[model samples]
Target: MNRLPRPERFILVDDNEADNVFHEIMIRRAGFTGDVLIFDNGLDALAFMRQDELRVPTCIFLDINMPMLDGFEVAIQAAPLLEGRETTVLVMLTSSGSPQDRERAAQIPVISGYVTKPLAAALVRDMMSA
Candidate 1:
């Protein structure tokens, strides 16, 4: 079976510094040799996403709770940009395991997945292999 292409860019939009560091390390441990962009808030991440030179096959890991804009808000605004882009995967990598949060994420067509904190290398590998 042919494996799916690994994402060329990994974008992490979370306010927690420690979580960002952990997630980045996890991505590297997964043997993903790609650009990893870390943003402390949703606005910056959205700005980078809006750039014309943004690479394809990008995976965005967004947190649910934030100061300025939350993950849901970002996903809603990003839906237009992500439309028809099969290579782009926007996932909610939040600590919240609430059913309400998951349901909200599911309502957003742009959001590909909703995962809890501490992103694992195995999951990353599976994402790449899928």
Candidate 2:
């Protein structure tokens, strides 16, 4: 089992405030010491990504639903931008179980995986190990 080095970065995108808070808490409780960036919408996250100094998160947890630039649209826009940086991984975290939702996520090259809502410690462990 190859574990990732310490100080891993994570970016979580979700419209719901409560979900974001819970996710953050879980990540911290897991003993993963790193910056957990939160974005309420995709546009803000994308904007931050454009900044030269913005640390590229090790993994991005994006929600399928959002106001002003949804998950799919964000992926479509941000994928190319992050391509030049090879270390980052994008995962769609959504409550959606629809095949169409998963299919849409699959279309984006930047998106590495799709996860259901309420991110668990196991999910964090697996993603960080990747």
Candidate 3:
């Protein structure tokens, strides 16, 4: 049994439902014992984030492309909400291979890593350790 947190809180921002399930499974199998919060759109995620009552996750797996407020915009908005809180790891979880996307993700101070879609256990482990 995983002796870690019963439900390792994670924010998964993918538009695809299957992708959500896959990552959720991968995360748990990776030894993360937390609830994976799924959001299809960055604006929806951002809306929840604006709520002071919203709980920040241990990490965020953000999708670069989404309707209404893409990952870049979400990152911009999420920064202030995360102020005064501990480092909540943010990583780009997307299929986007654009050099510009990488550059943009790098520019976001809150974003710790840029991960490709279909998050694997190894990537999860690396992020957890980082």
Candidate 4:
């Protein structure tokens, strides 16, 4: 595994705890030696992102089908928080492989890309290298 330049911090917003754990492992496997903040829901993640004391994370792994506010909704709502944070990238990590979902995510300027579930080290490495 090759080491890539890591961000100051990383954010994972997914309702599934199992996926979060798996994604964390994948991130580590990809050699991302940075803080990983896991949020079970979008609302909390958005709140944390909006906090003045909070540093903008390098990457945000967001699941699209969360309870309170879905990934699409968060992308729309997070526009303000994302502004001026060009280094921060938001990737939609969801189980849904629907083309409709991908198209919808494409419409959202906040979303950098859409990825399927069960994040892997290779994918993490690719994302980091990008």
Return the top candidate by TM-score: 1
Which candidate order results from sorting by lDDT in descending order? 1, 4, 2, 3
* Cα TM-score per model: 0.93, 0.88, 0.83, 0.89
Query: Between the candidate structures 2 and 3, which one is better when assessed by TM-score?
Result: 2
Please give the CA lDDT of all the candidate structures: 0.87, 0.80, 0.75, 0.82
Off by over 4 Å in 3: 1-7, 52-57
Best candidate, lDDT? 1
lDDT of 2: 0.80
Candidate 3, residue 39: Cα displacement in angstroms equals 1.1
Better of 2 and 4 by TM-score: 4
Number of backbone clashes in candidate 2: 0
In candidate 2, stretches whose alpha carbon ends up further than 4 angstroms from where it belongs are 1-7, 53-57
lDDT of 1: 0.87
Report the C-alpha lDDT of model 1 over 60-120, residue by residue, as the tens digit: 8999999999999999998888877777888999999999999999989888899899899
TM-score of predicted model 4? 0.89
Q: What TM-score does prediction 3 earn?
A: 0.83
Regarding TM-score, does 1 or 2 come out ahead? Answer: 1
